[model samples]
Target: MIRRSILFCLMIVFAVSLCACHKENPDPSGQNPDSSPTPTTPDTVTIAPVISGGGINLVAKLIYTVDASTAKVVRSTVMVRDDTDITPALVIDCIVESLKDESLNLSFDGIEYSDGVCVVDFDDSIFTIAGKSADLEDAILDCIAQSVLDNVDGCMKIIYRIHNEAYSTVNRHFAYDFVYMDD
Candidate 1:
């Protein structure tokens, strides 16, 4: 009788232990037994402007993206002029025409204004083709510089690059720097 009583106590203990374990580990399917949802922390987010602004009048801070295959202006910023007299659209059109006239063999992709710099990218062909004459090369660079200078207010200098690589300021055919100013 004593042995049977001891066995009965052991069975009760085992059953109780199993019940506790089951409660502790209710579901492996990722559901909580308490039915309360876990709290989530809010995430911090950062925002950037679609179009950047604030610079000399006429010179809109711009980033230009040039088409790689067609060598055309894919996009540009609205012209920021020194004088509010000129509209941004007209200035952009003039710049585009000037670029096309120069025959740089590339097109504008787009322009983004950020900080104080105007980053302009052109097609790879701008650097690929060799000019036959020094005048032609200089004219191309001059055209580029003038186009930006005429429409943009604060751009005294242009940092030109093709496919993100800096091309020589030298006229390859003439073996001399392309002079923008007489002095």
Candidate 2:
């Protein structure tokens, strides 16, 4: 009787220990071990815009000066993604990202688009450029406008802002009264 009682007590202890070690499963279905849904990856696309030699192309014309007086325009296309639902802000982002070599030191604070208009808020970094000539600034602005016009479908105009205020002066050379992409 004592041996049987000892065996019963040992079995009860073992059962209790197993129950204590058991963890509550977040997913009652028991299909997902981690109780988290599977993650999906988005598709990516690569585009190569033709680099213009000296003449003009149909994509975008970026005008700048080599010396102090000689002005030049270089035409090129912007890289596009394969995904749908492309917004005007995304196009502006692509244009900003494409200027890797120009050293324009341009950065946007925020971009909002609605009703065929895109309002870009830029930081004061653009105005702080050391040697930003009038022609170069004009070319940069034109490039941004032309790039948006060529890429975005519904966007008809672009407004520049510095710190949420009107971007009236870049080195006090650009009046920057909103640019119409359609024009």
Scored by TM-score, the top model is 2
Each prediction's Cα lDDT score? 0.47, 0.60
* Model 1 stretches with alpha carbons more than 4 Å out: 1-93, 98-105, 108-113, 128-130, 168-183
For model 2, how does the per-residue alpha-carbon lDDT over 1-183 read when each residue is reduced to its tens digit?
999999999999999999999999778787877458766532333334467554322333222212213323355444333444567666666555555455445787888878887777778765753245667656666666666665677778877677887675644422355553453
Show model 2 residue runs off by greater than 4 Å.
Answer: 1-73, 170-183
Q: Relative to the unseen true structure, what is the C-alpha lDDT of residue 152 in candidate 2, on a scale of 0 to 100?
A: 70
User: Residue-pair clashes per candidate, as listed?
Assistant: 25, 0
lDDT of 1: 0.47
lDDT: worst 10-residue window of model 1 = 174-183
**Cα shift from native, residue 163, model 1 (Å):** 0.4
| Model 1 lDDT at residue 138 | 48
